[model samples]
Target: MGERILIAFNRTRERTVAAKTRVADTPASRAVGLLGRDGLGPEEGLWIVPCAMIHTVGMRFPIDVLFLDREGRVRRVISDLKPWRLSPWVWAAHSVLELAGGTLRGSVQAGDRIEFDG
Candidate 1:
């Protein structure tokens, strides 16, 4: 496990997306991301650094994904991604945020700025 942080949506006027986000910056942690998890709480999330794409091969539930640039600006948004699916590669993305399904429906989007804080 890495540092725990908070994810805030800047475009939404500092609205928080995930208040308890885990950092998956290690190879081991990134490889095991959400594989055995049944589901995520509304305010929980995983932040995988240096990842432009991801798969939900062993995930049991759906999730919402945010592809962000180095500065934490969202480059793309994949909503309600189901298990066993592969997300398209985002060339400009420097990290990915995986949240509970439907979490970003009306909250975040491409071009939205995000902030990570401990």
Candidate 2:
């Protein structure tokens, strides 16, 4: 398991703990997103509660990235991410999460809150 990190963005209700300490995924707590070389969609979204890293050590397909706040709200959502792409520098990000291709499959949206265990 990756190191957990706690974070709360903007007008969130509380703080969240990330399972993975992906520092490069987040630059701050406002601008949270992913680095997409391909195209990401709702099918490849992740449901990370507090924080986590979607590490692609040896995987295929693109993934959509989502940035969640404390209120379980989505701060930012980027889609169609291929491979070998670096996430942009976000200034206001509470936490970061990653998922496999077509994994989300129309499950999450804006103003949605999720739970995670650290």
Candidate 3:
């Protein structure tokens, strides 16, 4: 699931949601920290980008959303996204990755290559 699953888009590339896709960028995509929205935890996360907004209702915790670029490089990561709040401008980003809060563990930073389950 890491080959085609880890597909890349041009942003200029037009795509439909039925594609079961994942994005990699910041400033373009937005994510909601649905930690516990549906019994979420530090290992499980729900990411949404090109989505216009992230959903946060009845959530129980916070999560981090990592934005990436075409080369799978980290652009920036927003951590502890509180429930019921919207993220900043993420349109300039190419894709966004969501992980459980505190999942970064010092490994995440700008210019680092990201790996997706794709």
lDDT of 3 by residue, 1-118 (tens): 2313342222322321112233323343333333334544444444344332344455666666666665556677777776666666655556566656676555466656654444
> For residue 56, what is the lDDT in candidate 2?
38
Best by TM-score: 1
What's the lDDT for residue 3 in model 1? 59
Worst 10 residues of 1 by lDDT: 1-10
How far residue 113's Cα lies from its native spot in candidate 1, in Å, is: 0.6
Tens digits of per-residue lDDT, candidate 2, 1-118, equal 4434433222333433223323333333213333433433432333443453344323356665666665546656666556655556444446655655554455555555655532
Give Cα-based local distance difference scores for all models.
Answer: 0.89, 0.46, 0.49
Cα misplacement distance, residue 55 of candidate 3 (Å): 5.9
Candidate 2 local distance difference test against the native: 0.46
Candidate 3 stretches greater than 4 Å from native: 1-36, 39-41, 45-58
Residue 97 C-alpha lDDT in model 1: 93
Clashes of each: 0, 14, 12
lDDT of 3 at 6: 41
Order of candidate numbers by TM-score, starting with the best: 1, 3, 2
TM-scores for all predictions: 0.93, 0.45, 0.54
How many clashing residue pairs are found in candidate 1? 0
